[model samples]
Target: MNLVIVGLGAIGGSFAMRLMKQGYDRIVGVDIDEETLQLALDKGYIHEGTTSPEHVIAEADIVLLTLYPGQIASFIDENKDHFKQGAVITDVTGVKTSLIRDVERLLPDHVDFIFAHPMRGSEKKGIAGAEESKFKEANALITPVSSNKEENIKKVEQLYKDAGFKTITRVMPEQHDEQIAYVSQLMHALSVSVVNSTQASPDTLLFAGNSFKELTRIADINEELWAELFSMNKDALLDSITCFEEQLDVFKNALVNTNEEELKDFLKKARLQRKKWY
Candidate 1:
């Protein structure tokens, strides 16, 4: 199979490495940065690397787009004609509603574009940080539009499974966005807010614990990429924040009233709810 991975950043490079390890040859890496392409090539994550997709896209059987959501539409708009006939295109984008709708509308009928989100990543960025282990035991969400062919959707699902994902499930784009708003985006916002709430000092490090370090780990983030993601899913994220604020207010009121019963009940319920995940 001839596979092309666009962007060649952390997630993209990791995907190339895992797929290559699974015995799929002809893996190609594409990126705007020549240095990133060179790093991917040198690391042996891909068999070939290029700074231009136009030259190699015609022969690609599958293309994994790891670009930011905004860039995906523009890239597809410009290179739709270059895609090989019957190629299956997938993505690792975080938020999906607008991107999936726009790409579905613009793509040629000859090819299939199945939207997917591999629910795994690291705090690090770039090809140098790529690791195949990121996908182990992670859930991959396949969000397919009505226009997608069932066979093509299955192919995309199998692709992730072959890359060592533990589970694959399907969801509509709207639900995917809503769930991600709470689970992913809201957590990032909370992490950033927590980290920024206090000025850093030697005293701060001296007093830090595992909870503090774990909570703020994601706060050391790629600002530009996260800003784009937060903006693209603004409405859903705002709804999530409002929900969180309501719960926080309840806790604040309980503390102000010194209601031990309310506080205990809240903590107990939270503990019980969290236990369900295990």
Candidate 2:
């Protein structure tokens, strides 16, 4: 099968690298930057590379769009005519509900768009930061709508399985957005807020411990990509933020009132809840 990856950034490049290492040689790469396409080829991540997606869309059996959430629908609409008949198209967009509706409406009847989110990434940026191990040891999620064929769903799931993802869960798009808002988006927001809350100089970081470093690690984020993700899932994320702030108020009021019992109960509940997560 001819596999084409669009927007060969960190996730796409890492996926191509993993596929190449697994002896899949039919991989092609599409990107807006000529240098990036050349870099991917030079690195042996793909057999061929192209800047013009429309020129080669018809050649793809599986087209993986690694573009940002905001770009996925428009990209499909612009090149819908060129996609091969019965081809399976997938994406690595983080947020789902709204984008899924737009893409579902825009896709050609002959093709299937199986929306997904690869639950692995890097604090680093672009193709330069791509690492095969990200997918090798990570979990993935697929949010398929009613129009998707069962065979196509299996094909997409098999692709992730082949890429060495440890788990690939199937969930509805609305559920995906809600859960992701809490687990992924809200965590990133918390990390970003924590980092922004203080003016930490080089000297301050020099004194930081393991927990501090660990919590702020993801603070080295891709601003434009995350901003788009945060906006795309605004309602869910806002709900998550509100929930977090209420919890913060609980701790604050305890501290202000010197309520040791309340603080103890809160810490105990937090520890118990965290244990359940594992």
Candidate 3:
């Protein structure tokens, strides 16, 4: 099976290496960045490299687009004509509702555009940081449209399983994005805000506890990519942020009013709610 991965960064390069190791021969990589393409090839993640999306689509049986938010549709529309017949295509984009509708509308009838969001990533970037085991035990959410074939969905499930991921299928694109905004995007925003809010000096840094360190772990995020994701899913994220702010306001009010009973009640309820979360 010929598989081509576009945007050979951390996720793409790691997936390519794992699939290659699984005995999937005929692997190709396409990336606009020559340096990244050369790095993936040098690391043996790809058998060959192509700077042109058209060339990769022409020969690949399956294509994985790992581009940034809003970039996938343009690539698909530009090269849909070159995609091999019956080829199964998938994406590793973080947000689903952001593009799935438009992508489904534009893709050729013969090609399958199964949407997937593997719930795993790192603060690091590039093929140099890629590791095959990164997908292990990671939760993969597959969002398939109506036109998606059952067989094609199964193929994607097996591919993730072989790469050491545990997969679950979520049919609707909007549902996928809504869930991701809460779990992934909200957490990143919280971390970034927490870290930025604390303009601590060197002396204050020495006083940081383990809890503070853990809470702000994801604050060192990739700004460029994450900014795009936040912008694309603006409404959902804004709602989440607004809800969080309201909760914070309640806490602030309780503190200012010196309402011990209310504060205790709030803490108890928060503990109970957190206990129910997985």
Candidate 4:
């Protein structure tokens, strides 16, 4: 398969690398950054690298976009005419609902845009930060509409599996966004908030426990990208934030009243939910 991966940052570079390791050889990496393209080439992540995708995209059987959530639709719209007929285009962006809604109509009638999220990545950026191990055993979610071709959907699933994802779950776009708001985006929001909340000396962390470090590890975020992401899914994220606030208030009330039973109840509820995942 001639797979053209656009925006060769960490996710795209890692996708190219891992898929190549799996023996998919006709892989091309595209990025506006000359340095990133060179890095991917030097690392052998992609068989070919380019600064412009106009020609490669036209020839591709599959295109994997790892651009920011906001840039995705615009990129597709600008390049839709170049897409090969029946080509399968998928993405690794976290948000889905609006993207699918926007691009599905703009895509060539013969082409398919299969929306997906890889469920994990590093806070680090660039081709240099790409690592195949990041996708190991990670959950990959495919948000395919009923109109999507069964063949294209399967191809997207196999692509994620080949890249080292252990599980593939199909979800509707709306449902996917809601769940992501709670699990992925909400966690990032909490981490960023916690890290920014600190008014203490920087060395305070030196005296802190592992849990604090672990909890806030994701706070070193890509601000522009995440701001676009949060804005794209504003309603769902706002709902998630409100729910979190309600729960936080429960903890605060328990502490203020010194109500041991209520505190135990809060812990018990959380434990039960955590146990469900385990």
Count residue pairs with overlapping backbones in model 4. Answer: 0
lDDT of 2 at 43: 82
Q: On residues 30-94, what C-alpha lDDT tens digit does candidate 3 reach at each position? A: 98889888877787778989898787788787888888867889988899899989999998888
Candidate 1: lDDT over CA atoms? 0.90
Q: Whose lDDT is higher: candidate 2's or candidate 3's? A: 2
Instruction: Give the per-residue lDDT of model 4 (tens digit) for 95-176.
Output: 8888888787677787888889998777888887888777999999999887899999999999999999999999888998
lDDT score, candidate 4: 0.89
| Colliding residue pairs in candidate 3 | none
lDDT of 1 at 157: 89
| Candidate 2 C-alpha lDDT tens digits along 75-164 | 988998999888999998899999987888888899999888888877777899897777876899999899889999999998898888
| Candidate 1, position 175, lDDT | 95
Q: Which of the two, 1 or 3, has more lDDT?
A: 1
Model 1 stretches astray by more than 4 angstroms: 198-202
Clashing pairs in 2: none
TM-score result, candidate 4: 0.96
Give per-residue CA lDDT, model 1, range 163-204, as digits (tens): 889999999889999999999999999999988885876689
Q: Alpha carbon lDDT of residue 76, candidate 1?
A: 92
